[model samples]
Target: MDIKAVQSSYARWAPVYDKTFGAITNVGRRCAVEYINSRGGSVLEVGVGTGLSLEQYKPDMHVTGIDFSAEMLQKARDKVQALELSQVEELRKMDARTLDFPDNHFDTIAAMHVLSVVPEPEKVMAEIARVCKPGGKVVITNHFERKQGVIASLERLFAPFANTIGWHSDFEIETVLQEDALTLEEQRALPPLGMMTFLVLGKSGG
Candidate 1:
């Protein structure tokens, strides 16, 4: 998906996101947040759409979020204000392909149901690896293309319509695992018929 398409698609979805896509992705979101909270520290959440998982973080955990869509960020900011979520340190408009933070800035980084939606996911993954602290965790939850089955066929069928659908149905997991500095620690199938996957990648260090 191109960046413009992503921005426009999310602008359209922002209004009903929490009740629609957000609800469907709830299981994976909760799972990621719970895992991060257990190892609380400074967190950087990529594609923090609507901040649905904001309040779930432990109060002691400092979180910073970024998104390319202004429409979506507004919703997130509103949630932070209305709920008085002090753990949310800041929310900025930023491109994942070029993160603004310094090297090894965050103890944890989260990308939830977002990689497929962003353009050049490989670049985004590299940026993620760059800013994550050594030995820190990068938690991800996303729908990857099925290898074989009825779903695989459907994925291929919709591959061309990524710009319209707002995400790539045939996105591969290898796209995220290419960063050598990040080692895969765990991988598992998530709920809703296992269409989504949960991954934990630990940055290498002492």
Candidate 2:
């Protein structure tokens, strides 16, 4: 999906996101953050829609969230205020492909359920790698195209409507593996029948 398509689709999703997609994605988010908290440090959540994971972050870790959708970000901002989550440093509206942070800025960067939805995911990966500290890690949770199954057939069927749905059902794991600075460290399957995958990539020398 293009930028406008993502923005519009998320605008519609923002209102009910914490109850809908947020609920469905809760497992992956929890797993990612739990791992992150174990390795505690400054964090950047790329597509932090509605800030569902904000309150879960350990208080010792500094967290900053960014998203392209203003509506989604507003909800996230509201959550931060409501919960008084001091761990959250900020919530900014920024495009994934062009991040505003300096090089090697964050200790960990988490992109939960967002790689397939953004435009130019490789560019997003590049930026993620660029901003990540040399010894830091990046966490990704997403659904990739299944090779064969009833779900694989459904994913293919829904492939053409990516823009409308806001995520490519046929999106591949390799698309987010473009950053040379990052090395794949771990991979695993998530709950709800393993429909999603959790990935961990450590920057070279991290």
RMSD of each: 0.7, 0.8
Q: In candidate 1, what are the lDDT values of residues 84-123, reduced to their tens digit?
A: 9999999999999999999999999999999999999999
- Candidate 2 stretches with Cα past 4 Å from truth are none
Tens digits of lDDT, candidate 2, 1-206: 78999888989888888888889889999999999999898999999988999999998889999999999999989889999999999899999899999999999999999999999999999999999999999999999999999999999999999999889999999988878998899999999999999999999864
C-alpha lDDT values of all predictions:
0.96, 0.93
Residue 177's lDDT within candidate 2 is 81
